[model samples]
Target: MKKICLTIIMGLVIVFLNGCEKVLEKTPDGQTTIDKVLNDFARSKGLIDAAYNEVYQARDQIAFVFSPLESLTDNAFWAATYNPYRWHNGSLSLSDPVITWDWSSPNDQLWSDFWRGIRLANNAIKYLPQSTVITEEQRAEWIAEARVLRCWYYMQLLEFYGPMPWIEEPIEPNYAGWNELVRPGYDEIVTRLESELLDVINANIFKPRVGAVDAKRVTNGIAYAIRARLLLYNASPLNNPENDRTKWQRAADAAQDVIDLPSYRLVPMSEYKRLFIGANTTPVDEIIWRAWTDNSHINNTNGVDVGSYPFASISHMWNCGESPSQELVDAFEMTNGALPVTYNDATHTTVTVTPEAAALGYSEATGGDPYSNRDARFYINIVHNMYNYGVPYNCTEPYIIETFVGGRNGFNDVISQETQRSCPGYYSGKDKQVKYWGPGNSGEGNEPTHWVLFRLAEFYLQKAEALCELGDPDAAATALNVIRERALQPRIQDVPGFANTQEFLRERIRNERRVEYCLEGQYRFIDQRRWKILNETNRFITGMRITKGGNGQFSYQRKKIRDYQSYTDKYLVMPIPLEDAKKMTSMLQPKAWQ
Candidate 1:
């Protein structure tokens, strides 16, 4: 009887150990095993494509990544009760779950999503080496691509949370303390990211551009542009305590690397707007890297960036979330490349008549048509009161946006009128219009906007900025001219009242970035932080209050919309999430976050 019991126990132990081994298997859930993926080139390609799909898969990819964050800067306003709004309004605490220290369960929050991407990249890198079906050269190239994708994830994290816990190797789910891992210092994180990117560049694995099949894949130009941006951030006041010139030089050189690449150039001014809103397959040389999506995955609903539209135009389902502030509207230079509309005070409601604005049919005394006689991009980027966009290709009647009080689509008027009949921009057939996509019978509008990641124009701006910092304003002006001339505006050197001093060039570069990249991403907020001008530039958000008289005359007042007076140096580097902070008790929060 004793011998029989011993045999049963021994058998049970063997079974238990086998089950444990099965649990530790390397195959990811819902994915094929590494052995199977590596044995076939088709499977390997699918694996790579899976990583790409993961990036563009977020339900609110653009809003989550870019739009809502615009509220943090002077460029936009967000009224929605979303994570980004909470962060923008400074309502987030250390205990906020989305950004907190607890990393146990991987949710779809920004922190978790990015960390998951890093894991996918690491897994791909690990599995690619085992492939016997592909050439060694192909394996090396694919591995480099994986590393670049990983670097991209890290870059996004760096922008929001500053230094994150760097994950060099793939951590198993069962690994102890994986949830509470502590992060390295800012410098250490930057160093590792720079090293990884350089290794890929040195390997010559990425191309300056990719074919249509691989439209948005990480390329040599994209990698270099990111490196340039990262170096610029590192060299800025936010990171460089001593304001290092070497870092600036490094950044300028990296940007030049992309500029030297002969594959890209600016699209004509005529085609500039189409680059963002055109069909998915429409080729544009200006886009360096984009999160490409097609009609099947397109924004069928009104949610991609509904905030970009005026409040009165959208239907009942969507709210006007993002509107251009008066500050942003004034940043656009005059048609002749003159200074922005001069204001009597910070209110910006009263414009001091300039020869430039008047030359383009602006009236100085009555605050002239603030929208008239601005850069061509202003017409493309913003929709102001009473501006009539040309007739839609599908519709014979031109669409006029009426945002004045008591007018159709007026913010206040629409609120009082329950019936949307008060809104009269267009009832249907808006796709023919170039600037907007209004709600039709289906309560939906489609505007296929590609969230541009990097472009050739930005590189020129980056080069111009670094050169200015290095006290080469002449060279900087030459670089800035590349964009200005492309926009059909006078070169900075030719502008009548323009000064050649460093101070003048610095302001010019700042203005150029704000106008060129507004509503595209977090560039405005990040740039303000780096330049240490949050107090002056981001403190009080402003918007236009439009009142339309019975005579169809429009009146405007630049009102201070939100008082973000709480902004300070600490906001420059966002704090680590609360739950994550709690788990890693020894890890210190970013300076002043404590």
Candidate 2:
């Protein structure tokens, strides 16, 4: 006889043993006495709460550094401006590096956390079958939620590690051979996710409404969002391009389903900038699903403060960790509906701009607009000439210099110490909380902000991109216009230099995604991977030179140079941390890449 100690608290049961308990346990009733904990409404809620814990754990544990790595590969940031040694200097390794420092490889942690989530979800599924505490419909809904969330966890593994060992069952000691599991191929993982997700979605088991601080918790909309994103990624150029059309079509359809649901809508134009800073709730209209957090033990603050503030905010104000590269900054077309070069062709010759030339609204003698006539999002996201009052220390407010410092009384002297100072053509105001001054005691206050995982706008953009990619120009235009109209930006036809062709539409959709989704943790690198544009444009950086004038004025000039020396195939898929590869034994690096 084996003794199994089962303790039921809330709705969860923990199985432990006094000592050396065998797998076979007999109860006094002559039934197999496996540790069984009955789940009531309270226990179910407790389990749900436990599942939500993974979001915070994932963020603080693995996501912080890993997420930034993706952005660093693209033009979003340079080594010099933020901390230089990390991604910019190529110092980050599977081993040791700088910035959000992590000594252990992220692979195991991410793997463990995701599985932990899966286990909790599995418990929910298993218990839902026999539990009599809740209504049948409610129980079924809970199961659907668990299944969707479980699939989502798997999706994360799929995206990062490629084909991971797929585990649907909760781990038990009886499964002794499970440790010898081998990684599945990409197709196997995809097939399982596709099948499971379809069933989960069709079951319609979740409460239709979004939850509060629980926004980060998995919901039906989130499942749909993940399916759409996964299918789209599979269809994009990054994976096998053979199924590009079919994958994108499925992606579009998934996104459309979310769009059709009245529960989600775009956050109004007025709330756009505030959406990321944690000011607004998941705007019911704009958010489909998000990992929820509140003021409790898991206050869900994201990396926006670390990424946006440039040596100013008190709590986390260091120089901007990920400054937008000149290339990305220039991606925005002039508000006047023309490329910067069209304004003055001569500026194209030089990369740096003299102070005199900069004030005149051009980056260089050749031509670039550092400040004037660009998309609204450009100004909203990139910090250029704005003066940030350093809270209590007003005098310490950093003045952004867009040109080189030189000569008597020049603007350059004001901001010369910062690397890539000349490129501060714009500061990211997106998600900036106005009340946050400088660090604590410096008069700046920090607030509990939530991480927004899903917004309705993202679905719209996803659909638009997919539609355009699938060669449906008109439908793509309609999708894009839906978002644009909400933003109050001119429609495609109303704007000048607009071509409604597929290629043009594609570019337009891409640009829209870049602007709309900047710093929300999605950007060109992922886009490049999905579009298979990494090889063509990954290393390109558009830069400008700044010069000072005698009157202490600063100016910027544009240079049309695409520098690609730093990028390599290894950069495409991050190198498997050497330690992780050694531990796994079977892990292989992505071929023909780095």
Q: Which ten residues in a row have the lowest lDDT in candidate 2?
A: 295-304
User: Model 2 lDDT vs. the true structure?
Assistant: 0.53
Which tens-of-lDDT digit does each residue in 509-549 have in candidate 2?
88777767775554455676556566556544444445655
Model 2 has how many clashing residue pairs?
50
**lDDT by residue for model 1 (362-452), tens:** 6533344667778888877666666675432233455566666554445432312122221211111111233344444321333555656
TM-score for each candidate, following the candidate numbering = 0.82, 0.74
Candidate number of the best lDDT? 1
Question: CA lDDT, every prediction?
Answer: 0.62, 0.53
